[model samples]
Target: MEHRHLGHSGLMISEVTYGNWLTHGELVDGDRATACVRAALDAGITTFDTADVYAQGAAEELLGTALAGERRSALVIASKVCLPTGSGPNDRGLSRKHIVESCEASLRRLRTDYLDLYQAHRFDETTPLEETLIAFDDLVRQGKVLYLGVSEWTAPQIDAALTLVKDLGLRSRIVSNQPQYNMLWRVIEPEIVPLCLREGIGQLAFQPLAQGVLSGKYRPGQEPPAGSRATAGGRAPTFIGRVLGTPLLERVQDLVPLAADHGMSAAQLAIAWVLAQPGVSSVVAGATRPEQVTENAAAAGRPLDEAARKKVDEVLGDLVDRDPAKTAQMMAVKPAWRTA
Candidate 1:
């Protein structure tokens, strides 16, 4: 597996990180989760991404069990905070109390003493930026979290945090941003990429296949294939619904042959497209099956060349979402976690 530095930091992570978002505790059983993780390790994936909010923390526990006997020092274990994990008023957000407590809980769940990277699941509009930065700095000082990151944060929010970190001389600053970036979803390209590049923050892009839409499995007018996330009854993620449109699906079909021409699966082509973009440190791909993990891991270090990328752009012509405003807009629409 190819490795890349997380931003300008010395820490290197596998270019393809195995992440468990909706699959672990929520969608699949423990045995299946373990099998997928084993596939990732076998494929040379050294990075694992999970969150405190995924399946109300069961995901972290499952990941911990799966990697129990592995050499901890060789793995880049990452998790996130700032999401509602309980009903209590103090159970969520990036407040100092929540951050500290959450870090401790995550360590226990992951069966680790320190996190390779701890990230804000999302920007906390309710908490003071200084308080949040200070809390992260405290974790760094206490040796609980080695590096810091944020997910889905706007360019302005990141800039403000970095400025505060510098002015306050905090020990920890953001090294990465986790955002949904793929061929179909390019919202982070215009603003976040430029800003992060300038500030020395790399992007650990998630949903590199647009939740399987770019895999060419969902036909333009046909029902979503059986057993797919799109067919997961009511358990499907809301984000998957956005890419199932006829126009998008039809355009996705055009790229299937393009992928074959390059000796890649549609999924691999999609992942390679994201890696080709600037400021991307890794692509976090989740899977329910072992072969899925194996397929995704192969996408690393095999980026699309200039002509191949241009052909992809022509095939996807005007179907991509590049609006930087969508970042803040998405944050606004996300349900606010209860503070009371």
Candidate 2:
């Protein structure tokens, strides 16, 4: 796998990272998860991304077990904070108490002493930005976290935090932002990408296939493939529903042949498209099977040339979701404020 520097930081990550956001303990069993992780390592993937809130923390434990006994220095294990991990009022958000405590908890769950990168999963509007950044800075200074990042944060939110870090003279600066980016989702290109390029924050794009929609497995009018994410029996991620429209599916079909012309599958073409974007350091792909991991890892060093990228845009014409407001919209309503 090809590795690239994360933002301006000296740390380098594999271009195709293995992320267990929806799979792992939630969708797949322990043996299957371990096999998938093995596939990633065999494919030379050195980075693994997981969040504290995923599968109620079971994902981390599973990843920890799967990665046991490897040379830790050869891996970049990343996890996030600022999500509700419990029912207690203090169990959520980016407050200092939560940030510090969550780091400790994550360290234990991941079976590691220090995180390669710790990120604020979302902008905590309720907590003072200074408190959050300072707390993350504390983790770096204490040697518990090596670098810092954010996910789904808008350009303005990221800018505010970076400014606070400079003014406060924190030890660590935000090096990356994790966002839903794909051929079908170009929201970050307009605002976040420009600001991050200026600020030296690289993007670790998740959902690079638009939650599997861009893989061309979902036909325009056919039922979603059995056991696919869309047909998985549970509360599916809303993004999957958003892009399953017939128009979008038809557009995705147009890219299938384009992928063939490049000697790649539809999914690899989708991942290569994200990597072709400016300031994107890596693409976080999740899988339920070993071959899926190998298939995605193949996209690492295979970059789509200018003409192929243009063909993608031409085929996906006007169907992309480029609204820069969606990032803010994601954080607008705090889940803590909701009643089930």
Instruction: Give the CA lDDT, 0 to 100, for residue 288 in model 2.
Output: 78
C-alpha local distance difference test of each model: 0.89, 0.89
Model 1 lDDT at residue 225: 81
Worst 10 residues of 1 by lDDT: 331-340
State each candidate's clash count: 0, 0
Q: How would you encode candidate 2's per-residue C-alpha lDDT over 118-172 as one tens digit per residue?
A: 9999989899999999999999999999999999998999999889988998888
Model 1 Cα lDDT, one tens digit per residue, 1-340: 9999999999999999999998888777689999999999999999999999988889999999999999999999999999999999999999999999999999999999999999999999999999999989999999999999999999999999999999999878899999988886688888899999998999999989878888898897798888889977434545677556787778888898889988999999999999999999999999989999999999888968899999988887776667787784653432111111
RMSD of each: 4.0, 3.7
Model 2, runs deviating above 4 Å: 237-239, 330-340
TM-score of each: 0.95, 0.95
